[model samples]
Target chain A: MKINRREFVKRMSAGAAVTALAGCMSNAGRPAAGRVVVIGAGYAGATAAKYIRLWAPDIDVTLVERDAEFISCPLSNLVLGGSKTIRDMTVGYGGLAKYGVKLMRDDAVAVDPVKREVRLASGASLQYDRLVVAPGVDVQYDTLPGLASADAQSKVLHAWKAGAQTVALRKQLETMRDGGVYAVHIPKAPYRCPPGPYERACQVAHYFKTAKPKSKVLILDANEDVVSKKGLFMAAWNGPYKGIVEYRPNSELEDVDASTLTAKLQFGSVNADVLNVIPPQRAGNIALVTGLITANNRWCGVNWQTMESIKVPGVHVLGDATLSAQLMPKSGHMANQHAKVCAAAIIAMIKHEPVNQEPMMVNTCYSFIDDKNVVHVASVHAYDASEKTMLPIKGAGGLSDKANELEGTYALSWAKNIWADMLG
Target chain B: MAVAVGCPLNAHAQDANSIRGMAATCANCHGTEGRSAGTVPGLAGVDKTQIVQQMQDFKTGKRASTIMQQLARGFTDAQIEQIAAWFSAQKK
Candidate 1:
């Protein structure tokens, strides 16, 4: 952002000349009015990029994503349930074009905070007045030594990222015999989507109910109990899938015997027809490599009001990569909210306007117990100026009373709306 | 000597942007600017009073809801009014 006046003027496009010139009047050293570079095209980054441009048409936004299309991890569990497909979850970046966001199909290999630049794998460097990084999570294969090898990873799928792995896991289920056992190991807390593993168990169970009734669904949870929508998930497991679904708490996986299809625990090992090992996770590799992570060496700490990285100025972190605030789940919905707050704040900062002081965010996560029944957990968070972080509003958010078919209809609509909100 | 080309946003513009931020949060389930893609009801161009009343009903549990009852409690009455007004201004 610290560029010579001539260089700044030269870089500004013809359409942006007016704003760029206006920016130069107040301060000789100020960055050109609106040059933002956003990395990752997931819920957070895509929304941030699009909203920034939508709100301020003059602002220049360049979104760098390694993948050509966005594969939503939100409804990916449905693919395993045989209710949805990978094609259903996939969305293209083509929508962003109408909003004037420049799309770069390349990996963000490194970020230079000092230089205010992002270096892509294509050997191109993007200079930015501000940087937004929403890299999501990095599934740590290293944490599970047994699953570190490529062969082991292929045999014991994670399917946490919601693309190829999701389809691969579904294929495995399709191939399993009618009486086969499918076991999934849940990692410790502070990972993306606490309710996700439980939902997956339901989806797999639903698939088994109609497709392979004799099949068993085993959940080996590392935590002492279910992490999210616990009561609702418990009701589903005990009610509809009583004999088919088995829940084991505090079953921390020691390692995996991929070849033997065994999950090694502290006391014993459980063998299954298929094993899914969701390894421990941390902030995505880009966040880690760029030294954006400040909390427990896992997540990037941020100023909640602006979503700006506390550790690095001129760089904002969003979505699952961030150290979530109190009661904030790392969800696509929450990330979309983060993107808006961050977008509004960044726009204000560039315009030298007062940022929104009392920002609020809400999270609503729905989980489908079966193909027809769904439940949800909701929370409302507002900034507490005194505390310097967002706190869940007392008596504001709560869980659903019960799982019902009505919620299932709403859940799908919610997905469609949110996808359009971020991509459309 | 400095040249003033694209001037900074005025106070009115800033206020408008701030409210837009709050309203945009609802877009996750409601649709961008309240234009829903399907099933869920759209909020754009609705009467401000109607929107406020509906939010109040959800907050008070007078209107049965699967999720709104929980989400509506998150916003203050004043914030709800602002969001309602913003959505009322959006094109249907």
Candidate 2:
């Protein structure tokens, strides 16, 4: 259905304003006012905090993040391939301050939904009129038997967060002996970035081909097939990096012996010089701690329109931590899009206006097959009224024709533009 | 001239604000307020009909693009018109 802004506001304002007013009166005997505290300043939280201040200057917005700098996961695979550096992918929070978002470098340990309070590790408590949590995803190392130990985890680097681990993994790749086996274990579906493990495989293969000529890259994927951009990834796997990259599907990792650098799969074990295990993941720990996670779900259940927590009022969840519908991959672009929708809805609710019933979001993910070749998958999702979920627009999105150098250039440009959109 | 039943000549300020909210997504590539700095053309001050026509072309296969083709198809015709109007109204 077509959603015109004027028509949508006209239709929704009457009913929405009444509901919001009633909620406000019951809670505070007044309109929703005061500060908004956003936790975890990743793409979602940072964008939400920035937009709240930009759209509604009167309302105070505070962004709480443990790290002072932001490291991007989008182009991070380039780091593993020696194409990009961590410094190139790193951004500071100083740009966010220009948007009037207060930046707090502190860990938020606990959140009290009823009190609308967030307690920090620094022993400071913050009260909020609205709260947005974009904690991303947390890797569940405990699910893998031998990976729970610190020594094992240190050896089996996920490097999913795009920081020190990325560098360490890169170093491991660089130091591998010629003809050494570099094994990568991919978890099952619903993981962050569907094509990410494949991209990692390609990147490492590219590195092995160029730097360590005889070194081989082995991919042990739990899923039966490539999760995304399957055609393009398969073409590249068989074309340029053939024989150098070997893929084994349905190889669910059961255990890891870090001392021997061996990953025991459901059927057999694979020994490698460097083991990169992308472990099973769930919502950020804070979601479970704050009771935002719904029953039988590892992620937080949120209203797609407003991103408000299904179980808790005055709290919203975004990014990978949210159990989003419409096959929304847990990618940075989707997180940024989710932030915009949540930001708009929060602003409308605060002003006693109707939140837009139909919100449109776009996700464009690019994967580098090599230093010069890249492939992408793009989709546009809109709120489906009858289904009550976000669904991809039919015939609106698809994968790139094939991996190409031009798309690689576009991929880099896309990263530069999106980073500027979020931080600059 | 008779006014259309659903189309208002002068929309509310809030309506424009909401339109801007949706249009902000375009700003990622189109540039802030549709004032582009790169090779991608700016939509600011462009004719609404021209913008709408190009978007329609992209949505269809008539006008090929590396990414715009997929992105344009996401919106309905009505949303496209609104986006066109929003960008056309902006200063160049």
Worst 10 residues of 2 chain A by lDDT: A23-32
Q: Across residues B1-92, which tens digit of lDDT does each residue of candidate 2 receive?
A: 32234224222434766687778777655665676654556778999999999999998879977778998988889989999999999999
* Residue range A172-263, candidate 1, lDDT tens digits: 99999999999999998888999999999999999999999999999999999999998999999999988999999999999898999999
Correct interface contacts retained, every candidate? 0.77, 0.30
lDDT of 2 by residue, A1-424 (tens): 9989998998787767676555433232344456899999888888888878877787889999999799999889999998999999898888887888888999989999888899999999999989999998999877788887888889989998899999999999988899999999999888888899999999999998888889898999999988888899989889999999998999999989999999998787899999999998888988889989984558888998899998999999999898868678899989988888898888878866667888878888999999988888898898888988789989888889988888887777666666766776
TM-score of chain B of 2: 0.83
Clashing pairs in 2: none
User: What TM-score would candidate 2 get against the native?
Assistant: 0.90
Task: Give Cα distance to truth, residue A226, candidate 2, Å.
Answer: 0.8
Q: Judged by lDDT against the true structure, how good is candidate 2?
A: 0.85
Docking class of 1: medium
